[model samples]
Target: MFTRKQFVSASVGALVAGTLGACSSNGSNGGSAATKASDDSYTLVQSGKILGASDLQYPPLSQMNESTGQPEGFEIDLLAALAEKMGLESGWIDPIKFDAIIPLIQQGGKADVGLSAFTITDERLKQVDFTDSYLDSNQGLVVKKELTDDAEAYLNQAGRKVAAQSGTTGESWAKENLPNAELVPLDDAIQAMTGVSTGLYDGCVADLPVVSNLTLNSYTDLTVAKQIPTGEQYGIAVSKDNPGLTKALNKALTEIQGDGTLDELKTKWFGSNI
Candidate 1:
């Protein structure tokens, strides 16, 4: 339907085919809620639920609840709300590697959708279909609270060690903007922030909502020095084999967006709508 929009050929999709939902969200796992959704419009990984694939470490977006040992965050809550709209229950999140989500979706036995903070692009479109864009996103700079010069300028020089999550747009942004800096690509965005907190790096680049949540709460010593507007939007990665699911999800997403559920979630988790 949306033929001329975003990823697969350039840096984003190709870089993220290894990144978003491949189908493995439906790849080879089985974890669903107790009550099965009775919807019959689309096929699902689990009969009554919408199973998901995730990295499970990024907080406020999607992460494992320390006490519950299950996934929680804006994405998780949004997923439940969307599933309910579709007459289904929210399924459990299967912990998958960051770069392996899309491939797993392609494999067809794991989960129903990939629930990570996936920035939909034409490159990723070549691999898996995406539902309508849910959240507008941008790159963020996380730095130690003590060093507060022009955030971008101070870090745009040689010898400034900056950490970025590998295979994410944040890495690409750092490469293009902080050309002279020593960019360290970590396994995930949170790791990049942790590396900075431990004094291993001067700063880190990652998604805005994620870094914003961390700096405001858990990592109090850190601060969001800058928010780089990348004009990126996050989407749910569904299987190409499951177009029905995509449409169904889009409908539900529209409902939430119209009803202000999305805005409320943003305010609850990120301290304000971003």
Candidate 2:
């Protein structure tokens, strides 16, 4: 008989072939980051735990819980589920810089994985390995409420300032699509939205799901003027050195897809499955 790992890993890639329209998530508070390093089934950075590096500011995917003072979001819950399947607990690098997440995973000793809604790109694949995509994403054009007249065209004009998180696909999209507009690279995705809300920028580009949630709830002053399909997919980042860990996560991810847990989580957080 094939091992569960063998069965799951074998069909992993086939499981999430087509991307789904990612929806916003509302997550439960997560465990705190730990310092201990030891393990069993796999040589994890920490014993009985999966240590992750992430920027805990992007809502629906990852963010800090105001009430609990801990990380909370879809990615956090997803990581927790993956860890449970591997008989490990989940913890993370609280409030790390978005661009620095991959580097910390590459350096080792700091984190075993990165789960900050990272897009699976050819360039990022060279630096770190990615698990099967969990969600399909697109870029959103977010503009201030006052920019009611043709927000997209208005922001597309020359000298119009646009904000996007540095080192992200949204920034790349702005560079390519909004070439006439000035691109301001912010340190965090929320900062870009805040800048737009406060009139510091005419607009910003970020993940559509995040923009949808924020515009509908947090930043009602902003609006999603456009959903730019970039064919981007989000993945859990694993180190090249940790093949066992990668294999373990892939197996767990496959199980989640097969057993309806993924659908359940999607509904719980996003209000429906994609």
Candidate 3:
């Protein structure tokens, strides 16, 4: 029987293989010519709806409300504001796997945008465009209380297992920085932290806000050992083919920022700690 750790590792490996194949075939459709129109003339993927795709498992950023079965998070609220400002109806916000959302955007027609806690990077920019960043972030480590202060030291040693979400900057950071440690790739931040709490992993690497939020709210046994200052920034992802949508989102973002709506949302969700 495979342990949970083995199963997760195998699953991520398969996902990476599938993602590579999908990317090769999709290769930026640029969508229909209709999607390439000017910002003022562009139409929604679906009439009267601003379709969004996200993995809503990360709390404070994006999570599902179990009682209402509706998506609710800082990113969700921000997207709602953007959709309203763009004069589109509150359309379908589909829940999707984090790594798959970019591919869906690249393929087009399925979603108009992606608003998970997507950190904008040059590599990601090659596949899809991003609106102006709304949040600055850093990579953080979460470990069991026993390893709290010495988590970094332990992670630096060989045979230590450190987990991170596959395809995220946190994973890349772990690979680059902890070359001697065994890198465990999980599906999301929540799972990575859970693994740490259960002693499946020595530590979990994820966004600073996410690790902090989870540690404070849900996983009291976990502590943020170190915050790696990567100076990351989260942005709303749009298809490379849909420059018009990108422009419109940027406009809405600027308005929210200028009118203090952005700050208010940040305070409401992240508090002064962020």
List model 1 lDDT by residue over 1-274, tens digit each. 1111111123246335675332212212443222212221345666557888889778899888889887888888999999877767887655877778988876666788887889998888899999888889888898999876688888888889999877788998999999999999777877888888999999999998888888887889999988898999999999786676788889889989999998998887787887
Arrange candidates by lDDT, highest first: which order? 3, 1, 2
Clashes of 1: 33
Error of 3 at 244 (Å): 1.1
Clash tally for model 3? 0
* Full-model lDDT, candidate 1: 0.78
| C-alpha RMSD for every candidate | 10.9, 10.6, 13.5
Kindly give the stretch of ten consecutive residues in candidate 2 with the minimal lDDT sum: 23-32
* Residue 180 of model 2, lDDT score: 86
Error of 1 at 240 (Å): 0.9
Tell me how far the alpha carbon of residue 67 in candidate 2 is from the true structure, in angstroms, after superposition: 1.3
Q: After superposition, how far is residue 106 of candidate 1 from its true place, in Å?
A: 2.7
Would you estimate the TM-scores of all the predictions? 0.82, 0.83, 0.85
TM-score of 3: 0.85
Residue 266 CA displacement from its true place in model 1, Å: 2.2
Of 1 and 2, the candidate ahead on TM-score is: 2
lDDT of 3 by residue, 197-264 (tens): 88899898999988888999999999998989999999988887767668778888898898888898
Quantify all predictions' global Cα lDDT against the true fold: 0.78, 0.77, 0.78
Reference-based lDDT, residue 138, model 2: 92
